[model samples]
Target: MNPAPSHPYRAAALLAMLSQALFCFRLSMPTKLMFDEVHYVPAARHLIALSGPVNIEHPLLAKEIIAGGILLLGDNSLGWRFFSTLAGTATVLGVFAILWLMLGRVRPAVFGALFALFNGTVFIQARIAMLDGYMAAFTVLGIAALLWAMRAESSGTAWSRWVLGSVLLGLAVAAKWIAAPFVAYAAIAFVAVRLNDARREGRSIYAALNARPIGGIHRHWPGMAAIPAILVLGTVSIAAYFATFAPAFFYTVQPMTLAKLLPFQMQMYGQQTQVLPHHPYQSAWWTWPMMVRPIWYLYERVDGAQRGVLLVGNPAVLWGGLVAVAGCLYGWWRTRAPALLAAVGLWLGSYVIWAIIPKSLGFFYYYYLPSIFLCVALAVSLDHFARGTRWDTRFLLLVLALFALFYPVLSAMPLWGPNAFHFWTWFPSWV
Candidate 1:
């Protein structure tokens, strides 16, 4: 039997490469600074100049990446944005790699890559100098490495995977403090390993735990071969992560926690915890599932007077993914794709953290981080359908094609008709 003729992954990769390059350079006119570019541009400059450590609430990894590009490209709009575009480009490949790793299928990987490329949030954030895209890139990389570790059958292979996973995971945290929750999942993996070992030894882990000496817990250690593998990998990765911050952190980020450092952390924590009254763009997490209020990051008049404007995510991609999340839930219920489950956990977990926050500072863009995983969830469902029906693939391809066509007009161009370009105010809260 012969396999059905399919598009070569190399061809798809080439197309993906071209699209990302075009996307990175397309809006080279550099219309105007959008949203947080105000804050991060200066931050990148300081980093490139190797000035004093910039005291910031967020993590330093994104700025470090931007600094690298600025050093090479020279400090300017494009120079600062260059790293973001590259990270965005890398994200397309990352999505493909992650899907392939989790599902062990090529078709899903292609669909995932295509969907990620056409996604409006991805497209916009990737073009600008911003931290969000870098955060997403590291996150996807971490997920891919973690999945690789889980699937490895040999100690050597597993150790390599774990080390890669740990390095990437640490990078993720270094990209954003929000990544702290992912540690929960990491701990789950360790506990899972211990449980498997105890089971193999015909002893309940709980029994060992309830026993007299905690030191004897190693007696039931599942797969002694695997533990060293994980520890070595984890240790080295952690070392690398700390090494990046060590210059500023050697005295600050000490092994023995200092009382003075606690106040700085306390102040940072306070900012995240503080809630403001009546933020126009603020909305509840419950509504995010429905895509009710999307943040408008940039809107401007072009052509010397009026006519051109730019909004956020393409409505088709944003709204379509919202509905598709339901499909993802159903698909997961039916098939239980572990990849889908993992994505849902990350996506929902990030959002849930914000929803529970007493602070009102979270905004529409706050949803941006979680949106990537939501798209993955949708992609997983689409992959399931693509395998079952030709119509589904064609339908989704059409939807994406239509989205790509309208995306520029909806996102970057001033197509709303004269001042109508700014008529994207479907929700006053989003204004």
Candidate 2:
């Protein structure tokens, strides 16, 4: 890994600004709720009116944020999507930060975040009033913070980073339960790393279990503080997750109380786990990585032209990323490189776990979190192959070209006619 530049934040800021510009462009073109937005935007409106509860199957933070956007911008397209746009940009920054911390290089970080920006899922999710975008943003930010905390040089800084990471992961769950797997991964990874370090330093099992922070300064030997670390992760994350329900207590009708919280949670769990009628776009978990099916958020004629929004990953990024992730897994086995291991762990946490989720109905968009990490794996693979060449730059340019090519279909850009979508739908499954 190369040393990061002293001014990495400047580059990260520029990338985020670019992402913001792209996400905000033609954002209001549809001027109407699309797909799941119809479900969520109304929930946000109800929150604004304190009109009891809506969309109770999910948590409240995401709707609260959407309500805040509506209050600030009024109930319009922009209002529904503005915070999602910001969350999307933050996810870009989070990807950049994760790569920078893992690879300790600016170039690969930029490439990784750019790949995420054009990955199709982020751009589409960011433009809608949905819960996944916020969940994804907080998920990546939490992972980045935890990664940094693992490398911290001081105990105080390490603890602070861990606490922040825990809080962010909690917020991610508060947005959507899909993020629950990531929260579990964070705690497990942290404890595993700490215990491994302790064993490597010749500590006994009892000592490892009893480890506690000594002074404010101890060369950041987190191995000596595994107990406190686990406690902080669990306590802080659970507290933060429950704190998001505070607004529920203020509702005028059937206001939530301490006694109702557990029942409300049970209701959410029951709703989430129940099987639903099959839909045309519902897909099996295994088919997601192959892009076998995509959800058509909008497809209609407007102003004598066909306009559509397709929630699909960029073929180049999603397909090529599979090979890249495989390479990362192989590279990690051989070299035990931290960056490669982190990439694979991210893929497993986000993608593989979905196979066991009790939810009977899944969609292509459910692969959003995995697609983000696929970009990271691709960046790592490209950087390894570059090895003093411009291969990474060339691949990035190719991704950018494809992003441009698909922008019309991804955005609600005017097309030639009803059959215009056929031009971009490469496979029957995609259609």
Candidate topping lDDT: 2
3-80 in candidate 2: lDDT tens per residue? Answer: 444668889889988999999998886887889999999998888878697788999999999999999998999999
Model 2 RMSD vs true structure: 2.2
**Which structure among the candidates has the greatest TM-score?**
2
TM-score of 2: 0.95
TM of each candidate vs. truth: 0.79, 0.95
**Compared with the true structure, what per-residue lDDT tens digits does model 1 show for residues 1-431?**
01222344684578467656767655543445666778787776766555644546666688788777778877765677777877777777777766676566777666667666776677777877777788778767777676665555554565567677777767877776676566456656555645654666666666433322234433222223444544654565556555455334433223223453446556657765666578655667777655566665555564443332233555555666666667766767887655556556656776788766566665555666666665566666676655676744674576577666656443455454445633455565444
lDDT of 1 at 39: 76
Which parts of model 1 have CA positions greater than 4 angstroms off? 1-12, 53-55, 189-241, 246-264, 275-279, 302-311, 334-340, 409-411, 414-418, 422-431
Clashing pairs in 1: 197-222, 308-414, 309-414
lDDT by candidate, in order shown: 0.62, 0.85
Candidate 2: misplaced stretches above 4 Å? Answer: 1-5, 198-224
**What's the true lDDT of residue 153 in model 2?**
70
